[model samples]
Target: MTTYYTEDHEWILVEGDQATIGISAYAAEQLGDVVFVEVPDVGTAFGQGEDMAVVESVKAASDVYAPVSGEVVEANQELEAAPETVNEDPEGKGWFVKFTLKDPAELTRLMDATAYKAFCDNQ
Candidate 1:
């Protein structure tokens, strides 16, 4: 599996044609204590960079964008009752959704782990 990241701080863990998506730990930390998350519904399709979900925190509410276009295959229903998981495990069980990638080529446009770390360091 390969992982990619958007400048907006969302990450996608790609496995075959499907990818699991989530906000990065940096984004979760910046957002502060997460209170709620609104994940996109299964079967929903979105263009790359589209607003796919909402994450609310004590600091503010933020839109979670699609790092790559695709049809939503599953959403983390566990978030509705345990949004704090985002703060605790932003890259793990806190994952927001899984989707079938619309264009696998799009993955090439995102940063890899090394590049993403450098990008964040500069920010």
Candidate 2:
């Protein structure tokens, strides 16, 4: 499966009906050493582009959005213990949550890695 990224700096990789979500590496770099992550409770629902969590860094607080409408199935409780993982590895160990996708077609609204890189460049 491929990953899709948003203008809000969120990234998602959809595999089957589930998607793993997180802030982009660029966003983590800008946030400057993540300190805490305020996340939604598992089983809560959010719409596409909805604000589901807030990631706080030494520099600022950034919102984490739902790449597609879905119910949050799992969260990274590890982040509450060590949010710095976000800054250390935005794509891997840093992933914030997993959700059951609402509409798989909404995945088309996002940019692929190549497009995400261009979007970052334009910003």
Candidate 3:
């Protein structure tokens, strides 16, 4: 699997044409104690950079954007019951959605782990 990061602090873990989407640990930390998450339903399609989900925390409510165009295949329902999972494991079990990539080429526009770290460092 190849992982890509967006400037907005989202991450996409791509394995073949399937991708898992989530906020980075940096984003979870910034959000401060996630309380709720609204994930797109399966079959919902999103264009690159469009709002695909919403995350709310003690500090604020934030939109989680689609890093690339895709159709949602799964939404993490565990989040509805234990939203704090986002704080505990932002990139693992905390993932918001799974998608079937619409265009693999769109991934070329995202940052790799190294670039994303540097991008966060400057923020």
Candidates' RMSD to native:
0.6, 0.9, 0.5
What is the model-wide C-alpha lDDT for candidate 3?
A: 0.97
Q: What is the lDDT of residue 12 in candidate 3?
A: 100
Clashing pairs in 2: none
Give residue 74's lDDT in candidate 2 (0 to 100): 95
lDDT value, residue 90 of candidate 3: 97
Tens digits of lDDT, candidate 2, 2-120: 79999899999899989999999999988887889988899999999889999997767778888889988999999999899998999998998999998999988899999999999
Judge candidate 3 at residue 80 and give its lDDT: 95
CA lDDT of each prediction against the hidden true structure? 0.96, 0.90, 0.97
Task: Tell me which residue pairs clash in candidate 1.
Answer: none
Could you give the candidate ranking by lDDT, starting with the highest?
3, 1, 2
True-structure RMSD for candidate 2: 0.9
Task: Please tell me which model should have the higher lDDT, number 1 or number 3.
Answer: 3
Q: Is candidate 1 or candidate 2 better by TM-score?
A: 1
Best by lDDT: 3
What is the Cα-based lDDT of residue 59 in candidate 3?
Answer: 70
